[model samples]
Target: MLLKYIISHTRLNESSVKNTIKLLNEDCTVPFISRYRKEATGNLDEVQIGDIVKYKEQFEILEKRKIAILKALEEQNVLTQELKQKIESCIDLITLEDLYLPYKKKRKTKAETARKNGLEPLAKIIMSQKANDIESIAYKYINKEIKNVDDALEGARHIISEWINERTDIRNSLRNQLERHAQISTKVVKTKAKDEKAQKFRDYFDWSESLQRIPSHRLLAILRAEKEGFIRVKINIDDVRALERIDNRIIRSNNTCADQIELAISDAYKRLLFPSLSNEALSKAKEKADEAAITVFAKNLKQLLLGSPIGEKRVLAIDPGFKTGCKLVCLNAQGGLEHNETIYPHPPKNDSFAAIKKIASLAEAYKIEAIAIGNGTASRETEALVKKIQFKNNIQVFVVSEAGASIYSASKIARDEFPNYDVTVRGSVSIGRRLQDPLAELVKIDAKSIGVGQYQHDVDQNKLQKELDVVVENCVNAVGVNINTASIPLLSSVSGIGPKLAENIFNYRNKYGVFKSRKDIKKVPRLGDKAFEQGAAFLRIKDAKNPLDDSSVHPESYKVVEEMAKDEGVTLGELIGNEKILQKINLKKYETQTIGLLTLQDIIKELKKPGLDIRESAKVFSFNQNIKSITDLHTGQLLPGIVNNITAFGCFVDIGIKESGLIHVSNLSDEFVKDVNEHVHLHEQIIVKVLEVDVSRKRIQLKLHKK
Candidate 1:
């Protein structure tokens, strides 16, 4: 397999990467792999491993295209031994297309008709520079059909043009040159699109830029600009330079026909190379952008998915609103909505104190562990008021981002689940659930709605959606599913399950009771052996009588595992204990391809993992409660905060409450900072001292300079 070969060539030496691939093929989740295989993977981080997974997917795409191109060439009866070798050697889709450009069929054009008239030889002769007299050389091919110099020259150029177009090597060379030099530009046509509704685009008449360096967000913006009918767009580049390369490489030899050769090369490029290469460049640029945007989107999703979970606890979620009142939803530890209410303690509430009093009573009565307040209108005021409410011991309060919560609340899934609840109550539940387990809840909504990517909407929607879906599946599967209580939406995203099977699982659950063991999943409707094989490794049954069910070992492998245990002179149950014996056996001798030695080795290790919760542990961050707001901060005061976002310049920190503060790289330790990712990462809680506070601008500068 190419995947196997890639593993050999890559720098990833961790036992985890090998284990990850085997696990992935055998149906293990990324979260499961990273969390459980620290030793096996040589402790490779999730980000690096996830990158490997994504690259593998891209490689698969290129391989499929390669097969299709090879088939097409063979069918045309034009496939040569050398051409086949070249095609087989190409590693990327772009380079392969560059090779295939000439052999690809084309429309009937002036060039084809000229070749039919038999002037191609004269064109080649003129281009060869072997002829003494150009007129006489041209004259030999002249007949009533050949005509005068104008027609003769044009025909010769057309013939030479196609000849240059056919040379695969020259096409590849020019395509590369054009890509490096080409710039993309766009302009508004002012001419209204069929719809006159959006006139904004009419003013943005024209725009342009280089293809290589365009940022993801900017490219998406330009595409959006064009969509709104604001402008027409086209790419600009040194077409002459590209044409000149072909002239120098092929036509430079024959000085006799050097003038016509240069002219013919220029015509060929303009008529042939230019159009073909431009399309390829534009298409490749978009493909790259889509890939990058999808990657960012997938990473953001994985982050949101793998966000810490607060299981089976009482939570009060608030959808902060003004004038309409703050909508509240109380959810049990399992994320089911238990009750809902509304309060307006910010402004225009009949009696703000009464609302606060009622909130306090509910907090105490429900025994809520956390109050997840949505960061929205009047949220600050609400937070201030919530502080006044007395609660039972240490009820932590968090301000959760409500980015796509409203959209999810208004979605069909929400309506199906909570037909009787209002939009605001559903939104509150989303906000609450997101903080509990961002990954599990966010997977229910589309990735685009989560808003982590640049120019998501402007890129290829279908392509982006497919890639993002894979990312979600990969992430969800990475973190093993909780079989007892996972929602249909979550279960459906498990590597092997689809919408239909997901629904069937819910139906089985609703009809029967919670599954007592992993094997009991076979009882679920339409869950066959293949589906079970694929889905088993990622489904966790914490309460399963056997620990193996909760791990990555598939049920199909359980027999072989029993054999392993027996061979070791122990009971299957005993094998579960005294785990060091697992490394004693070599999987290669097992004699079952269905369950390889590599995979069996994984199962044995998983058999020793501490708990079924194969997720990163929750971190500790005791904020300086004194520094709740920037206005309260004094210069030179040091406080600990969680790094929420990283940019090219610095990191943004959330100091226990409302607004997060900026810590520029210059002050991030009084040392040089080359990469923001190198210095910090998402959700890394750290300590910093305040340097300056411009409350007027709401900017608080901090210094992270430390030993």
Candidate 2:
């Protein structure tokens, strides 16, 4: 039953969902199943597998809620066979909640007070809509609780309102109306309108838009404004039309009882129904907006994490600044900090000659093959200074983004890694290491702090973290980890390894020696068979005795590859990377029940490019020398820029300035732009024509340059 619902909801293959769920239940990770268990999942990618996991968990939560509702109904002695079946078969939370609404516990309210006054019977008589003289019927119920016939009728109306509110048909009708016709409107709090902190949200002070048509970023902005006491947000619809819809569902004739029912419907619509449904409508919209924002954030994070890496080389990295001077650190090929110092080359002391000599001497002494300068304060001056020096070796200079570097440097992780160093030196090291390998160095910092997201802080934190964690795991496993050199943070992102297990592996390696092969990880305490099965394939060991250990071929498939190698009359080392021989081998001959053509094909592909880095090598990028700041910009000027951040509406470009420039979606192309990512990617270098400049606001508007 749950499987059918998941299939209907997700539109995924039944067999694939079933197999993926089974693997998930048995503790297999998404990366492991997608990479090594393709046969079981019909070649579903990580995204599809993740969808299955999501729906399966949702189904479990629904079922658990059903059980809780049933238990409560039985305890109340209101459980009927028909109602039990209805609750048991309900698929969604909203529907199930509607069914259980009448029985839900409530505090002291008008309806409860009316029931205590013995007016429920009179209310039921009015609901029947047959009695013409309802005042006389109400008179019989009058006592100390009800002083007059009008008072008795009002009490009965309150009871009737509760009944109307509890009706599933009525609630569903109102929900449909709210879903289709709700408009979200906001108004300025008069006092906050003049507040300085409220100026960012000034545009939304008197805004109104269809809830369905509003963009996610705009919705989040309005919500944040309301949350911060700058504005009052309300979800509204045509009240008269809404009330008429409820009336048509309840009222039967033009009699006194029908009139009483009409009055009750009005009370219900005003006091109970519309307010509840309107809030629900706003909450649902916020949820959808959050989902869209999180998806954008996750995509941006994946691109940033997988950004180009300049492979292992001796590098001198600089964290540029003005008042504080530039912090410089020399990192060896393995990204270990060899030396550190400060240089004031730009201003204050005007020590350009001494700073230049010190940098040149350091570069030559450390045998620096590449230079990484952080794209921050005084970055242009630093780059210019570095370019003037004539070096012995042709050292490539790259302006690496320093987003989240300061946060990571000041964090406990940095303190643990560099106990004696200050935040400045640690930040400089991070700049250099990120240039060497982004995935390895970035896993230590919080992704939200990386500055690639749109309205990241406004979205649901738990949901964002979950999604980003999955993306990190996929990216980490996609580019297989070097078992010997991977840091604890990097290893912790592996398929089944958590922080504790990663620490154990690191301690084991440190106490004993480096991991010689993938199999050596099994010796670490608490590293069980399950962890090994899920993680081993994503770990690489260089110069191992078994050449396949350096590749992504799982240990379980070792025998299959070995068989293929034996048939080819060569060793595993000789058979690997021999595409000519690999392609000639018949895959059908090696197919087993567990290992089908899909698995065989993957095995062959892995043998071809064993443990190849899936990312491009980082290239040196220099911003236009003339455009140093916003004041240097003008309209119709073509300039080179790098896409630093992507949002739902557009992408922000870094044009060698402290403030990034925005390229709205409309300016991206002549055609309609659906997704910003399709036109540009994070860190993509491109040429843009300046469209407008608001120098006072530090805003630069650009359009993609075609020529």
Candidate 3:
């Protein structure tokens, strides 16, 4: 039953959805299923498998709600066979809640008070609409609680209004009206509109847009303004049209009884139905906006985490500052901190010659092959200083972003990694290590703090974090970690191995020496067979005796690879990277019930490039040396820039200045750009033509250079 529901919603093959659900239920992570269990999932990638997981979870929540509603109906002694079947067969949450609405418990309401005054029978009789003399009928129900016939009719109208509010057909008709024609309108709070903090949201002060057509970022911005008390947001629809639809569904004839019913319908529409349904419409819109914003954040984070790595080069890193001087840390090829010191080349100290001599000496002493300068205060000056010096070796220089360096520097993780060092030294280490391996260094900090999101604080934070975690896990496993050298944070991102298990692996490695092969992971305490099955393939051991250990091939598939090597009449070492031999071997011969041609093909592909980093190697990119700030930029001047951040509306480019330039979606190309990522990505080098510069606002407008 769940399989059919998931397949119907996902529009995927029945067998694939069914098999993926089974794997998810078995606690298989997305990376594990995407990489090692390709045959079971019919070759579904991480995204497809992730969709299945989402739908499966949603189905479970729906079923749980159904069970609770059923129990509530049974307890109320209203559990009819038809209602039970209706609730059981319902698929969507809205319709399910509609079915359960009439039976739901409520607080003290006018309807409950009317029922206590013995006006419910009168309400039902008037609702029947056959009685012409409704006032005469209302007279019989009058008592001390009702007071008079008019009072009795009033109480009965309240009961009828409540009944109208609970009717599924009437409520659904109004819902359809709101969904199709609702417009979100906002009015600025007069006192707060001119406040300094409210300037960013001024565009939304008196704005009105169709709810269906509003962009996610725009909606989120309006919502943020409303949250900050700068504006009042309302979901507006034509009340007359909505009320007429409800009246046609409930009223049958034009009599005094019909008149009373009309009053009840108006009371319900104005007081109960429109309020609930309109809020629901707004909430649904907000949910969609949150999802869109989260997806943008997740995509940007994935690109940032998977940015090119410089590949284990000895780096001299500098956290540039003006008055406080530049903090330098020299790291070895493996990213171990070898030495740290402070150099004052700018401002207060004016120690340029001495700082230069010290930097050159440190480069030679530590054998620094590259220099990573943090792109913060005094970055351009420091870069110029480094370029002026003459080193013994040809050291490649790069300007790395210091987005979350301070956050990581002061974090508990950083303190644990460097207990004796201060935040400045630790920050310099993070900057240096980022150039060495971006993925490895970034996993230690929070994904949100990395500064690649649009209105991140306004969206659903929990959902944003969850989506970003999946992206990080996919990228980490996609690159394959070296088990011998990976830190605790990187190991924790591996599929199925969380923080505790990561710590255990670290402790085990420290006590028993480095992991010799993928098999050694099994010896870690509490890292059971399940974890090993999920994570072993992503953990590489460089120079292991079994060459397959260092590749992406799973331990379970090592036997199949060994058999293939035997069939090819060569040792495993020779069999690996032998593209001609690998291509000539037929994959069908190695296929089994558990392993199909898809799995075999993946194994052969991995054999060609064992544990290869799919990301490009980081290259030296220099911003135009002449442009130092927004004042230096001129219209129509072409400048080299790097795409530092991307959003749904546009992308931001760092053009060797303190202020990054914006490439609006309209300016991204002559044609309409549906997605910003298609035109640029994080850390991508490109030449952009400056369009305008707002020195007062510190904003730079740029266009993508066609050539």
lDDT of 3: 0.92
lDDT of 2 at 563: 97
Give the 10-residue window scoring lowest on summed lDDT in candidate 1: 195-204
Local distance difference test, each candidate = 0.73, 0.92, 0.92
Which lDDT tens digits does candidate 3 get at residues 377-484?
Answer: 999899999999999999999999899999999999999989999999999999999999999999999999999998999888888888999999999999989988
For this target, which candidate reaches the highest TM-score against the unseen true structure? Answer: 2
Please state the error at residue 228 of candidate 3 in Å.
Answer: 0.5
- Report residue 458 deviation for candidate 1 (angstroms): 3.7
Q: Against the hidden reference, what TM-scores do the models get?
A: 0.77, 0.99, 0.98
Ten-residue segment with the worst summed lDDT in candidate 3? 622-631
Regions of model 3 farther than 4 Å from truth: none
Better of 2 and 3 by TM-score: 2
Task: Name the better of 1 and 3 by TM-score.
Answer: 3
Task: Give the CA lDDT, 0 to 100, for residue 453 in model 1.
Answer: 58
How do the residues 360-423 of candidate 2 rate in per-residue lDDT, one tens digit apiece? 9999999999999999889999999999998988999999999999999999999999999999
TM-score of 1: 0.77
